[model samples]
Target: MDDPTPEVADQEAPSSGIAKAQPEVGPPLVEMVNVWKRFGQGAGETVALAGVDLAIQPGEFVTLIGPSGCGKSTLFNMIAGLTDTDSDGSVVFKNKPQRDGELLGKVSFMPQKDLLFAWRTVLDNATLALEIEGVPRAKARARAEAMFPEFGLAGFEKHYPHQLSGGMRQRVALMRTFLFERELMLLDEPFGALDALTRAMMQRWLLEIWEKHRRTVLFITHDIDEAIFLGDKVVVMTARPGRIKTVETIDLPRPRGAEVITSPEFIEIKRRLLGIVEEESLKSFASAGAS
Candidate 1:
């Protein structure tokens, strides 16, 4: 497999002292062209996504946010090859069109829940995907054990999910995803269930891990602040029959500290994103009330 790290060109920083990722030279790692998805038929028919066009460059941390029921998970399913797009559109992976289930195993996916097995030890759980790939259990365990310290699970190798705190459980889940070793990772609200402080710490830890690995990431989150904090670009979707409402490039410097959130540029971007998200949320609420 080719290296996923992007080659960024040097550019002058913006007046706000924020630097942005310039356009890369190669084809996008994944591209969705005018994608659409629908369910049922006639009066019962519902459109989940409509004419959605998105492209993810290699080694980019792209965060997606939208109103509830805006088809975020559905979009993720398509990208992960769990489902097919409508006939009228195309989902291109590595510049090739992908059919139903074709992208499976091509991307590592972690949904909202940790989904750790209570019966297995932390090391065993982290090695599950590798073991399923037909790797010898011994070899898989060896590899997983080596990552324990990096994931902050050292000395807890023999512990089960029930024995760990919520944050620790999430780290284990993430370790499993990373160990699977895919070019792209689809993370859907992995930190949503954590408390405020834990979530903040996890966000920082995740960035550190991401910087080390440089895997292409597509993260879905409801928190606008989280999206801006962790993304190279923040993609905002509209209400039901979801489509890309806007894609805001995050210009804040990386290795970002918590103090950066209160920076002028961060606040400015948040204000803009908040307005767009709030407008979509209102529309979603109005539609729900009518239904």
Candidate 2:
């Protein structure tokens, strides 16, 4: 399968202007306050997060990056409502405080791995969400088929997971995620497994998709460049028992190409993030060493 290298024409350059720097502006699409999490009650218990506050605006693309043990996935699980915060915290989405499990199957979640089944065809895998949502299999397949070209899997529908490359597999996973059609998307390193060049292509494709679909996104990655390149705001979390260390807004020109990565503006943002991520990464290492 060929990589998705669609040349997104800058037709709407005016509308694609870099978003103005207004961190956490207007009503939040999702909000978490004083969030805390612990794995167990006894001495061996681990604190995954602490006093974490987050607010995401509708249609904004926010990328989260932090240290290895920084509870980034834990926070994602909490937001997905697969797990709730500790008793003292709150998880609110679309203005309502969600109860436990309220967010399951609500927002589309693409985890670290593609999780595509080798037994299923590409079309089958992409349409699984719709099928599970009570749509007829034929109808679900039709919906997925229509978007295959857009997703770079037009003629590969009959192919199984093992038949595809790493980038192709990730695109199928993303197609599945997009088909689910949730207001908010939680993508956890969707392109992490790809090589550097493949990763870049996927990043460009993702931005074009985001521009066309306009879904609010929360992407988690450990790469500072990826975080800054893809986010309206780059959220940095503190080590272990994580807290919101900083939320740096990326005020760069949108419809961003790989060229933006080397621009003075992008470098400035990356430089600032480097300091924070390095500091937290060191803290994470030290914390683990102590334990």
Candidate 3:
């Protein structure tokens, strides 16, 4: 397996900054065209994904929901250029050579674990990416410092990872990812570690942040409720050797609140997504039992 590409570390790099004259809205930001990923060699090979074709429009929040081993991470790795597809059946992102850094700082990814540094203060950890890029320490710290307050991490800047609660730690981790200044974000179970109440609060907090920022986001999770709650569209995948199952647009109104989850429209959408997920889950269970 080839190593993943290095992430771009520029904290203050001039953004792509499209001009108003161009109207700035054309093609989708990322396109995965007939992508397939298989792991290992010969009989031991695991076919993780197959024939995936999807386009994520700018500022769209898309979610992927499926049982474990459904190739969710495999798909993510392809998008991040962390893994390669066969030259024939490949994934194309940002309309450039998939191997290039064209999409590097333009996209940010937050993994399942918070992965915060134990030794560093929250502000230091958040600015580490910028520090690595050779941004002056003072400048990086200043940029990162302001975000702690914006991310609801105001009082914790001086604290370490061990000093924060689970949800607070996750917030810091997320701010760190955001400081990379990407136009897109890929999140994998970002709130899974939190308690139910904290998860609900974080969900609401995330929506508020997303509304203000308007970046394209592709989020992966096993939680059906979360998928429906956070996504503008939910894209389902098959059990193994995952393929596009369905893409359901969430018709709920923007700036959705907790009450929206109880509305008839929201319930209906959740019911439909749950039905599809249930069907796929059964197939996955059966396949595992047979093996």
Worst 10 residues of 2 by lDDT: 1-10
Compared with the true structure, what per-residue lDDT tens digits does model 3 show for residues 218-279?
A: 99998888898899888887787676677777888888889988999888988987887787
Q: Rank the candidates by TM-score, best first.
A: 1, 2, 3
TM-score of 3: 0.88
For model 3, what is the C-alpha lDDT against the true structure?
0.78
Q: Using alpha carbons, what is the TM-score of model 2?
A: 0.91
lDDT for 108 in candidate 3 is 86
What is the model-wide C-alpha lDDT for candidate 2? 0.85
- Which one is best on TM-score? 1
| lDDT of candidate 2 at residue 47, scale 0 to 100 | 81
Candidate 3: C-alpha RMSD after superposition: 9.6
**1 versus 3: better TM-score goes to:** 1
RMSD of each: 7.5, 10.3, 9.6
lDDT of 2 by residue, 46-165 (tens): 888776778999999999988897899999998887898777678889899887788888899999999999899999999999999999999999999999999888899999999999
- Give stretches of model 1 more than 4 Å off: 1-24
